[model samples]
Target: MTRCRLCGSQATASVVDLGATPPCESFLAAGQLDRPEPTYPLHLRVCTDCWLAQIPPLITPEETFTEYAYFSSFSTSWVEHARAFVADAVERAGLGPEAFVVEVASNDGYLLKHVVDRGIRCLGVEPSVNVGAAARDAGVPTLTAFLSPETGSAVRAEHGPADLVVANNVYAHIPDVVGFTRGLRSLVADDGWVSIEVQHLLTLIEENQYDTIYHEHFQYYTVASAIRALASGGLTLVDVELLPTHGGSVRLWARPDGVAGEPSRRVADVLAREKAAGLQELSGYTEFSARVAKVRRDLLRFLVEAAERGETVVGYGAPGKGNTLLNHCGIRPDLLPYTVDRNPYKHGRYTPGTRIPILPPERIAADRPDYVLVLPWNLRAELAEQLSYVHDWGGRLVFPIPELSIVEGTS
Candidate 1:
């Protein structure tokens, strides 16, 4: 952590130091809960040279993603988002029956399934054994391995260079930013495109989305830093799109250095926005730590007062971001006795650091708690509707990030 992971510079600045917490997705089994749980320093620093905000690479992707607990298909909105992205990408790239598409870190073929439906040749590079099996079961061709330079070249040799390589929500997950970008460059044809969707540091600061910072997400990006990261891999930035996923994300389109045409005007427009926000300098980050502290205080106050009133409060999702929120706020089972998730794999397990029990979604209805805390507030629209039944018993939903607020029902 002394040196920047993206740039080899010793001059770095502290952004936020979310105290030690276990790996966000490391849900513990009942037997293991009795044993000691390991925690690491969950601190994020920015490279003064490159402006790339990152955390220490304390955990490897293999450790967390091999038997991954998350399944992209579980979220209805996410699945539809993937479907729409596939359709738009195909049309924009002039993809045909003969065109080959590949998606790195493809979870359970959520995005590639749409490509399969269109009869386009597609492959999924997923590291998780269990989720990769699910992708295969769903008839999406998959290779079980992490994305590295060697892995990318091996795929190219076996199936030929892809026309389009899609990577979503995984660009920031790798510690070796330069190596991962090179691997991405190795996956596509000389003239093919690589589209990546990663959380934008701009909105993360503007909206107080510090909960998204965790060990798995090693680095966060701005358009300026992203352009530099792409150049390190021998790729040229072509276009950019502002997206609503993961609080706020940027969809970057790149191609081989020479083949990539002049940069799009949107790229300059977004860069202008980032510059206006002061993200390229130290001024943008000075107040972020203060805002993050306020978020922790406001949520803790609500949970404590509710407990004092003898009112019951439970959590709604066991996402990685939720784990960060819970651990950073020092919340324990005494305040949030249990949380429910749609994924059955975590049904009987416990959250990594907080030790809060994870139950099935139906448990909320069965117990009818006074309040249901929605941890994955990024999906406010979707979960608000899914949990509309809480209104039946006068149970309200609470969102902790951006500000603690209560909602009667669907937004």
Candidate 2:
């Protein structure tokens, strides 16, 4: 963190220091419980010179993505979201059966399956071996590799240049931003479209969604910073859309600078919103550290009082963001007991630093805990309906972020 990764600037300011925590996705097995887990500094800093918010590159992308546990198809809503995006992209980009679409970091073909169904030619560049095999099993063509400039050129040479290159939720995972953008340009046609979806820093700050900060995400982006980041590789921003997924996100439409005209009104509007909110300067970040501290205090207070009252409180989902919230707040198995997830890969494993046991979703209904702390607060609507059966036992749900709130289940 001595220098900004995006721009070579020595002038930087501390936004929030989350202390040290293990890589959020490093789940532990029963046999490894006695071994000491490695932890890294989790402090977040912002570059005043470029306004780019980033954490130190403590861990490499290969260490985290080689054998990933997260599968996008597990969530019904997420799969549907991908399906809708594909349908819209086809019409918007003038894509047809003759056109080719390439998706970088395409997880388990959750999106390309829709493309396949439409009779459009598509290939997925996925990093995880296990998930890439699953995508192939589902009849989706996938290449198990990470996107780099060399890899992109080979793909173009073999399969031809892509008419539409879609990169969703992976703009922040890459530490080498400029190199990755060059890779994107190499894979796309001279006048092709490049669409990327990432969580918006403006919403992350305004809504107090601090749990999203983790080692996997190297940098956070506002519309202003994103415009500059994309420009580093000859990609120009032409349009932008605000999305509600992942708390709040931005869908950026870019193209090779050759055909990129003036940006749309939406891009200007979002940038103006960022400026008005003081994210361009230091004023907006001044009070963020205090707000983050308050969140940790409130969550701990509720859990401690519940324990004293002889009440059983368990967690609902085992998301990566949940690990950040759990470790930062010093929550262990004694407070949460265990958390459940639909992803079977995490079953019988333990969370990285806090060592909370992860069990199957069926465990919740069998044990009947009094209150279930919903860890994946971003999926509030989808999970509430799925967990509605809790109401039969007079159980309620708790959300820790955007302020702690307890509510009854949906009937």
Record all residue pairs in model 1 with backbone atoms less than 3 Å apart, i.e. clashing: none
- Backbone clashes for every candidate come to 0, 0
Model 2 spans with C-alpha error above 4 angstroms: none
Model 2 weakest 10-residue run by lDDT:
402-411
What is the alpha-carbon lDDT of model 1 when measured against the actual structure?
0.94
The positional error of residue 323 in candidate 1, measured at the CA in angstroms, is 0.4
In the range 55-77, model 1's lDDT, one tens digit per residue, is 98999998999999999999999
**Candidate 2 global lDDT:** 0.94
At residue 318, give the lDDT of candidate 1.
97
TM-scores of all predicted structures: 0.99, 0.99
Minimal lDDT window, size 10, model 1? 402-411
